[model samples]
Target: MKKISPKELHERMQGEEKVLLLDVRVEEKYNEYHIEDSQVLCLNIPKTVIFNLEERDELAQITKEQPIVVTCTTGNSATKCADILDGLGYQVEVLEGGLTAWNEYRK
Candidate 1:
């Protein structure tokens, strides 16, 4: 899976790129804070629940061929998610250091 730093992702978003930004952190943590326009799909949840083929198809509603950027609290879970999506033939990228990195960028 490809990995991108939070700074690069931030710039991409600022440019109004039609990206599929996914927040793979837990719901509570996501509620506390997340990058604008990111959709939350907690990594702790079972993959069967979130990444089923049907679910992925549904997720494609937002951006079928667009770039997908996955993020978690750090970067591990998001990378895993990217691998899954990659295996499914989607273009996916992981946000390096995840939301922690994004938060740091904001400061």
Candidate 2:
């Protein structure tokens, strides 16, 4: 797994890179605000409960080879989810500073 800064993420998106931008923040927060209109698809799977059987089962739909970038409110939770996904043989990256950094970078 790798850590990508929000600015780097923005640049990648601008370049139309294919990535799976996974938002690990809770659904409510995700609904309230999120990264909009990027080259990648953004899916919300709250980190707090991702380890649950249902969540992991739902995530099984994503292919193993897909490049996935996980984000949370502050980046800590993203790291955890990244580790989980990496252990499961998925290519994973952590969004440095998470959505907070993403919002700051957009500004």
Model 2 clash count equals 0
Cα lDDT of all candidates, in order?
A: 0.69, 0.85
Off by more than 4 A, model 2: none
Report how far residue 69 has shifted in candidate 2, in Å: 0.4
**Best-matching candidate per lDDT:** 2
TM-score of model 2 (CA atoms): 0.90
lDDT of 1 at 99: 83
Residues 3-95, candidate 2: write the lDDT tens digits: 999888878887756668899888999999888774878898888667775557778668988889899898999998899889988899999
Stretches off by above 4 angstroms in model 1 are: 37-48, 51-63
